[model samples]
Target chain A: MVKVTCPICGGKLDIPEDSLPGELFEHEDCGAHLELVINEGRFELKLAEEIAEDWGQ
Target chain B: MRIGLAYDLIRWEEKALAYTIKDLGHTLELIHVPESVFYLTEPTIRGLDVTFERCVSFYRALASSLTLEAQGVFVVNTFDVIRNCGDKMLTTAVLAKKGVPVPRTMIAFDKVRALEAAKTIGYPVVVKPIYGSWGRMIAKADDESSLLDILDFRENMPSPHFQIHYIQEFIRKPGRDIRAYYLWGEVPVAIYRVSRNWKTNTALGARAEPANLDESTKELVIKAGEAMGSGVLGVDLMEDEDGRIVVSEVNAVVEFKNTVRVTGYDLPRKIVSSTVEALKA
Candidate 1:
């Protein structure tokens, strides 16, 4: 597990070793959804895209 | 086999599908749609056996599927399925033509004719954007005043897509609606999106519970799938005031994560395996 801080809230999140890039993890404490991204060889967390009007099932 | 997964946003469904495909020992390529540029002359997606179209946005899903399909990649939920299900009008027409029961719907191009159509369908009708989901931009107009108010807002929208009214009869449902997973020819699992609000979309706080599909529902769902040209589909059904099951809409790029959670069904695995079977065929 890799430890990272929630960018939206200062809470901790544990990313699984098998977690792939573009997979989403929710910060339960802050109720924010974060995306797992690999930037410059390091895995980082960023807020997921807001639901756009065209986004649907 | 080499498989491609085309997606705009990675949700639980996408991730589950990706993991499932990997677990099945298939070579998986993630086609990030936002960054991947498709050239009309040159096919970028070469050597992939099949591509599962998982784009949440209808436009992105259709555009990517068209390009990928033209490149000779067999897209799950082909270009036709994406195009038909992306627009409610097209979905309704396809279902109705196939003898599948759908809510009475009328299309109008302008506000005046829209009101006329609404009056014909009777008041308290549901106005929907032809191309939307998750219950967004859906308004129930109880009377002329309410409908006018709704139409006025749409009249000024920048996109003409909003102006093209797709009005449907608001079925007096039993405080819930059905969302069934139609894969290829089978209805694997279904859930009742129960909500106090009239809009029963899971995205809008509707609680999901496992639903038992009767033979009639299973048949209807399968028929609807056939009408839509097959793939992974989410068929939304609602019981009308007269207790008849009617198809509310069909989603080509259906999300199954919630259905899996609520029912404990291995939908992602099923989807991956089924997609592989489709590839072989």
Candidate 2:
């Protein structure tokens, strides 16, 4: 039940625990995707698209 | 009254500190940072005793001499805040976590992963050095190849680099960004930074203009500063397409050239007075 938000529209997002550390979580409200990573002992988010096909699958 | 000013040879901060000390009738101890330690390693306190051994070699010498327990000395901004603000990746992550609006950003450890991440972030994304300032090494990429070319050059360099996760919004005011200067949670002045280049930094030949401190902008700046737990700050902000404001970054020990010139406010006096009051309490 991790709380996330849209990088573009600032809407609330729900991130499933199974999502990989470097996966992208898209916001339903504004279609904004964020890059998720673990930094400084907590889950951090970044806005990134996938380079290869094996991203956020 | 002798006060020690510690910073690298950045003209803005240097001038601000000099003016403040001189006007306040205090002797200034100018600590000239040599080329070797211009980029000090970010500080982290591991279980007390304040170890700086992990910092660069040159800082080891300076760290040992610093009196962390000095009485009657007012640190312009504490070392802790400076360390946090120095890392862009860390700073944005903290602000975003606290529900502050920050542009979308990302960081990857290696080039392979970074390439994958960059593609996911999409085109027209900005790539910035994780530990850089004054708009140095900031690049915009429209595709994977361009990003790779930039990354290849950066990887070959001696310093480390990180990718900026894209923020899907136009610069509300092109070649312009807002900087709000705060003293102890109060904004004394707000300045708009304008430049023809994408990076609107005063250091990069940008022009400075006085900005009206609207209530919402002021609130956002204050919230961003408080999120980072910074006392004296220069907060960078921009508006999105939907007219929503998001914080770009926060600098702990802010440079005050354009701020002073635009607002016609004495930033040094405000900083010194606020610092001294904080120390007294």
TM-score of chain A, cand. 1: 0.82
* lDDT computed for candidate 2: 0.62
Q: Which stretches of model 2 miss by more than 4 angstroms?
A: A1-57, B7-16, B25-74, B161-173
Best by lDDT: 1
lDDT (tens digit, per residue) of candidate 2 on A1-57? 677655577777777654434455667677766766545535656675333211000
- The stretch of ten residues in a row with the least summed lDDT in candidate 1 chain B is B38-47
State the C-alpha lDDT per candidate. Answer: 0.89, 0.62
Give the range of the ten consecutive residues with the poorest summed lDDT in model 2 chain B. B49-58
Estimate candidate 1's alpha-carbon lDDT, on a 0 to 1 scale: 0.89
- DockQ class, candidate 2: incorrect
* Clashing residue pairs in candidate 1 (N, C-alpha, C atoms within 3 angstroms): none
DockQ of 1: 0.64
Error of 2 at A34 (Å): 47
lDDT of 2 by residue, B1-281 (tens): 55655533224445565666668876755443222233234442122211111111213223422333132223445555655666677788889899989876767666687777766666767777666567766777777788788877777776433333322323445568888886677887888888878788887798999999788788888888888875788898876556778888787656776678777888878877776565556
